[model samples]
Target chain A: MVTEGREQERISVLGIPSLGDRFAVFETMVKEHNISLVTPPVTKHTLSLGARYSPEFACLPFKGILGTFIECLEQGADTLFMVTSFNACRMGYYAKVQEQILRDLGYRFKFLRFHSSEKGLIGVLRAIKRFSNNASWPTVVSLFRLAVAKLRALDELEREVQKIRPVELEKGTADRLYREAIGAIDRATSFASLRQAMRGYFERLEQIPKDAEYAPLKVGIVGELYVVMEPFFNMNLEIELGKMGVEARRTRSTFFSEYTKWGTFLNALNDEKKELQKFAHPYLKRDVGGHGLESVGEKVRRAGDYDGIIHLAPFTCMPEVIAQNIMPFTKEGIPVLTIACDEQLGRAGMLTRVEAFVDLLERRRIGNILR
Target chain B: MRVGIPRALLYYQYYPMWRTFFEGLGAEVFVSSPTTKLMLASGCSRLIAETCLPVKVFCGHVLSLANGCDCVFIPSIHSVEQKVYSCPKFIGLPDMMRATVPECPPILDPDVDVNTGKRDFYQAIYKLGRPFTRSPLKVRKAAETAWQVHQTFQRRMLSGLTPPEAIEGMFPQSVEEPEGNGSHPIFTIGLIGHPYLLYDEYVSHRLVPQLREMGVKVLSPEMVERARLRASICELVERPYWACEDEVIGAGAYYLGRGEVDGVVSVVAFGCGPDSLMIEVLQRYAKRLGKPFMQLTLDEHTAETGLMTRLEAFLDMVRRGKRPQGISPPASWSQRGGSKRGSASWVYLA
Candidate 1:
């Protein structure tokens, strides 16, 4: 340990994986530390880069993140961060495998990963200490609080966008506003500015001229996290559904809420997971890894609120495959459509399937009134 | 009462114990027939197209046993060792069966997780025995007997017998062991994969038998000593917490590093969650060691001729003693690996 002082005495240029629009929050948090964040927008080339080197059967998220890492490294990043889990999910091994792959590709980068749930507060603090470059505990704590607040505000804005999108009087107004709101949120660095942006966006989203008499069909989206969150991966399913005048709600909590639920020491026992397993008891008796239990449980829990359920997953995703297989047995008395996406998935085919599913739900709703 | 067990998945690994436990409870154990094209086809018809091949085969076996027994035992094995988890599909196997195979008899599904704690593990075992006996003593005795049989089976496997060869006590005598072509020498090749994939003659397309006929000696993961396997696993920068880590990563690393085997061949079912990652790990190790590595992915659509052709080519390479030269791994990391002394030293703390 004492002999490698030369190797250990380098500046750390940190790279964080891209997932949705959460890059804004990651940037704000890491900016205060000595580590500089590499924010790479996931492009078509990124997906191709990831898929080329990644194992043929790994999930899309792995491919996407690996591509992002490669991009970051190309942009002069020396350290990369990833979140791992200790469950039966393949996410746990992502860092290890990706590290090996990157190493074999001749990159000399530092890889850091932790099971966010198992690590708890102390683990997070230790991890922060490593990347923060000796920042005081109080400063780190405040920065962490800001990151949490920013994440919550972003999720709130997203939820509002989903609601106003379907019933907006003008076509495409809601989506246009959403793109602008995301940019505003990303630029707001201070707490006061972030709060102002959140309030202003919420007001703008709410005032999107709505048709008073329109009753949009409501659907719940559930499945693998990456596929559900990344619009490009799912081919903008929410925006497409909104264009078709259907309201889509995400049943899976955002990653921020997920962190609060599982990353804290208090929630280490996984009461939420146990509760989901309970709701899924009659169909799925245990946690099937990933969001599978929640997929089944949310359907059972909120079957009455939505006209239908849409299950989206990356191809060959284990837990989501289990969820898709078990969704039928739940027999929640609602139409359920399972769409498995991969690089080979065609946007046209996906849209046709969604259209047919929405049509079926519409007919069912009208038929119920006739009865 | 008759209890049905599928001759697929964990059945190859735990048939002895399961048979003993059911028979000790005074019930006749009925095992479904080995995998066949027809059974796999029927199973495939009922499942999502993306399910791994083994689970689909298990589903087929369950369908075949629909009318043959009073109840079918499908244990959801979550974790066998502490801090290690089985495949997600395995944990949800019972639920998959419940949803897909409606015609099947009542399922006696037990949740098995020794990682959770010994008490809960025993409770699950006892619950599986409850319908047959009310006395707790009978359940404990049956459980003890099952454990003894399982350990003996593991010992037999460790003694270098494949599961089928050990269980039946009959090795397939090669009609003629082909001489390694002309100037090439016979080689010892390490075969690593899940027991279900490796031992199933139909799924594997008689890989072990074919390798034996080629005059090549085969070393499977089961044949490796437990201590050596554990030690080899520690060599990994981070130990895989997968329940079957020993079968793939540990065995592959041992063979690659120890130079006991000429080359390592891994058989992974297409779309397997853990194998997809572990195979990559093995490939990297093989690259680092300059050992020839071939990954054969089996699926429902796998052709027998293609498998045989690949096997013959791989064996030929091993016979000639050609090192597979591919992409070089990170030089800095490998140099660092040499200096890192212990298992705990490689956690990559920055």
Candidate 2:
């Protein structure tokens, strides 16, 4: 509550674990802006604490974020910044609801919600400025650019890792290398070092002796952003697929690309998403909110290329619920398995489902080849 | 051609306008019967398990209409007001209906988005009318007449009539408000919820009339003026994104703050995202004002006796003038031996 010595106090920004590459970029930006950033590691304890405090029917992402926020706050985070939307999805209300719940529980912290509906980069910059204690515009701009570059490099490395995961001769090699790669990217302070780190990581990934004869089953991961991206929420779905010798391709990986590519002011412009809108037209027709349209489009577009599609979304997610219902009707020949993740979902159950789906895909492929 | 409109969701609110619009174009409009056990069973069987009850009920109506109608009209209403959107389920209702009920007739979905501009809103209406008539001028005329009828319907509600009553008055021959007992109501209680839940006799188990029978007058959000409701929500940190939620919150805030009503009862559908948040909002506000507040969350399995017992108990507490002053932990109102057919749960937040 004391504003006089606020600068002397540590400023910690809560990070979403789902944003794999963007997390590193965010850390870099915060450091450059001269603000201390604190990212509490998300664990089972975090999930429990979040689930306990959150409304019973709230989505997994909301509960996960609440849990992470509480953890960060416990570690002396004086400020919490969150991105909120005014869309049709329940996502729009999560911030306000979480803030109220936290406040009710007597947590003392400055809560700042950035409305994504705010036009262009002005909203984002304003949020950045407030978070950075009004850091110079030039400094903010430079750091943002650096973060974007790092994010791009990180995404490329992740894609390479995903590609090599299933066919690697040495099991777990891709996972181990990817972890190290993320660490390197996070530690890289300069743009050149970031590029070099990514290049080095990709080279290491390529060296993982892969079976040339093995045609790995390719499964496209589609659904809500958090579940698709956050390994914990989805119970390490991609990793599980890798262990089963299946390549998992995600639809939206480059988190910051949409905002960063269109200069600082035009952050909301998403041309790639426009193409998805077109692709999903036959089934979805329009945006049903959240990433519902994207989920449908990605599956439809990649139906021929992928062996199967796994849709992971939180329970009670309206848009994904709509998508899941319509998916059966699409009849794209690709087996689509929808996994609704929530606090009630257990690891064993999720693993069993994922394993069964992989087995089905493998059988279908084998059957096709034989025929 | 006969056009079917499911008496679910927005049908309770906009049936007058839609019926008028379709009838003006010379199409015989048929509305599905009120929710019944058969419809609920059929809906639950067809719909995805996670969707809210109203959506399932809508699916049932679609199924009913599929039997005899040429096409079912389901509007994808993105935003009814500027800067405020509807729930995602409402926006994607048409698609969900089509996907769920494979036996459903052809769906005539017209996009109604006021967020873009007024022109787009009218253009969407005209596009929906194009299939009914050739002349754009005739469509415009029909739209204008329908708008007037819609305005009149809203006026009737603002004049202190419930949504069902207003709709009944609008279509005297088609629907009728059940005649009230000659006894005058002794107490007033604000009943807040979406029109679909509040007015649907089968979903609510005739809660409005039951309250009236017990000498309590029900005041719904529909009775309040739109401007006043909007003004009342100034206390909120942000305007609720969902249009119906905004109104409910605004009206609930007004009723709770005014101190005239004995208590506020919110009827929420299970799995409704907006209602879940709004209930919290109303609970917190009601707690601050030291008012008796109870949330009746309904699903397909809600029992009539359990609901009646909770209502009777809530009313008794109100009449005794023993409103709980402090905030209480959320507690379920389920009774022993209650029918557990649906996932209906009640939470009492004083």
Candidate 3:
């Protein structure tokens, strides 16, 4: 525990981009608790610092978290609060691994995880209380209320994008609206206020025009759903593809993909277990981790409705790798363009692939279908 | 109308078994012209989003026979192990095929475990065969005899003869050796995937050595031939309906378990409906056993460089150990083998 008389000093909370979402919560929470918040830069160095020090098979999130922890520790953030979940994916225990990895780096920051105490309202306050030691109840309550509001707003606004973005008259307009809605969510103090702010953001967002013409090429986004739906995960490929003038069609929505892909996570039903097939690619073969996004992608292709396919998955994800191999068989005649990204991805490079893929699709469209 | 068996996958495992039942029922059988491009394309096109590419391709081949035959003999996978069977996708395949393909009568095996055994598979065939003739008893007898011959022949093949020659004495059989062509370094590729993915080379486009063009030889469990692979079986119970997937993976496990393969690589369908349950165990074996390995996922959009680059990198890691600090490891590897530090052999793909 920190010394009781450690000046009640102002400790700044620092984070990398993945934690950028938590910045507003941190700003308000730290203030109420007489602390400060600092967000670090999203840089190649941030990634290298992580890539240089993580397990080879660890997902990109691990790398990003490592960078955040390092940046914060170096910047004198004495205490770090990690928010994680009981996800069906292995990432749920990421905090434990990250904590171990960070400690090995010899940083003396106090790691306060949300789960070590209560998982809900009462638990969060207790962890904060124990961590801060000097914080009062009222301050905790206010911080809790603000954090809850921000988290809800973030989830609500992101979900709302799926509803509006796909149906919007403009191609990229809903995405822009999503950004604005997120900002409104970040600043929101209450549920009612967040809803009001979100409505206004959406209204204003709808005013922008998204000119998505069929453009002779319909590019279907395939592979693991995590990278396809999550912008932060795949470096905003959908928007980039939209800008490249290609209608990027993805298979699963975030809600269903994340929730259902890991349906048998606990194996509670005592499902049929078989001998593990040793594939050339363990990372690519298992469909259990992610929603059968690879299967979903293949099914979409076999339906034979698209021009080309774009597969996006995290670096070491197995199901996506397996799907990537069998895809050639699924779409025997169609041109397929696959891309995988991690936190280390450069925006320009990813865009280059999307651009090239679109170019190929367009050439095929005009050269064969149109003629 | 006759059903065509591809003589692949289940046929190898259950042909004598399935044939006795089909022939006893007086069903004329025709298998595909081996997994050629046309049948593969036909099978590939017939698959929907819910199935794996190999299964999808199997459907394509099944559909190829559907037009000329009375029914496509793709069974409803109700149970693989008495009751707690194979993957749910396999169980629902006949339904999926029935829904996806309209003009075909999907010959199904509802449940093939104990009480509802191989006879159940034939029951469906008998039901279909009833449209042509009467007498399920005659069908049963024929199925049993045909199965006896098929099993006897299967035993011969497992005794280390070619698949064709082993059955030659049983019927007017024609056996031919697969093209082993040249004496290339038997580049050990760990065909680590579900049975369907490994054996159904039509779907796993990476099965052969296109990657080997860059100097790699392919090694897979299926390529090892079941006869020579008996030593790979870690555990056994005399069970006819052995999870074909288990056996296939057992074949790969045997390959890696043998410890002779230079570098092991795994290729799986992007969303393997079945391997989901199986991979956890395989990973424990691979990761814990410290096997030199790489895994590549196949789906509609897997990139050439990414696959080749990963393959090359795994081979490189096995070959060079690691780069000597200055030379950059291949950009494809997200985490470089940590500055030539790893004890295992995983080098730069480049």
For candidate 3, lDDT tens digit of each residue in A205-315? 656554444343556666554356445656766666655665556442333212112343223211212211122122222233344334443444334577777777666
Which candidate, 1 or 2, would have the higher DockQ against the true structure?
1
DockQ of each: 0.64, 0.57, 0.03
Candidate 3 is scored at a TM of: 0.47
> Residue by residue across A288-369, what tens digits does model 2's lDDT show?
8888888888888888999999998898888998888778787576789999988878999989988988889888988999
**Of 1 and 2, which scores higher on TM-score?**
2
Q: Score residue B153 of candidate 2 by CA lDDT.
A: 93
- How accurately is candidate 2 docked according to DockQ? 0.57
Q: RMSD of candidate 2 to the true fold?
A: 5.2
Contacts from the true interface found in each model, as a fraction, amount to 0.77, 0.56, 0.00
Residue B75 alpha-carbon offset, candidate 3, angstroms = 4.0
Error (Å) of candidate 1 at residue A149 is 1.2
Cα lDDT tens digits for candidate 1, B1-350: 99999999998788889888888989998888778999999999889888899989999999999996999999999998877888889899999899999898899999989877989988998899999999888999998998898888889989988877665542223133332322333778899899999988889998888787777788899898888887888788456678888888999898878656777788999889888888877776765555677899999989999999888877764554432334333455345444212221121210
User: Of 1 and 2, which scores higher on lDDT?
Assistant: 1
Number of the top DockQ candidate: 1
Residue-by-residue lDDT tens digits, candidate 1, A185-211:
666777899899888877877788898
Give the CA lDDT, 0 to 100, for residue A319 in model 3: 42
B1-350: candidate 3 lDDT, tens digit per residue: 47656544455455556655666666777766556567655655665343455665666666666667656566544454542344434444454455455676545434343326666666665675565468777765765676677657656644533333334444455454443423665355555555455444444553453644555555545445555444443332112222444444465566656656655566666555334323433444454445565666776555556666666566666654333546644555535333223444233121
After superposition, the stretches of candidate 1 with alpha carbons farther than 4 Å from their true spots are: A1-12, A187-190, A261-272, B170-185, B322-350
Tens digit of per-residue lDDT, candidate 2, span B218-288? 88898888887887776764565688874578889988777578788988888888877777867877665
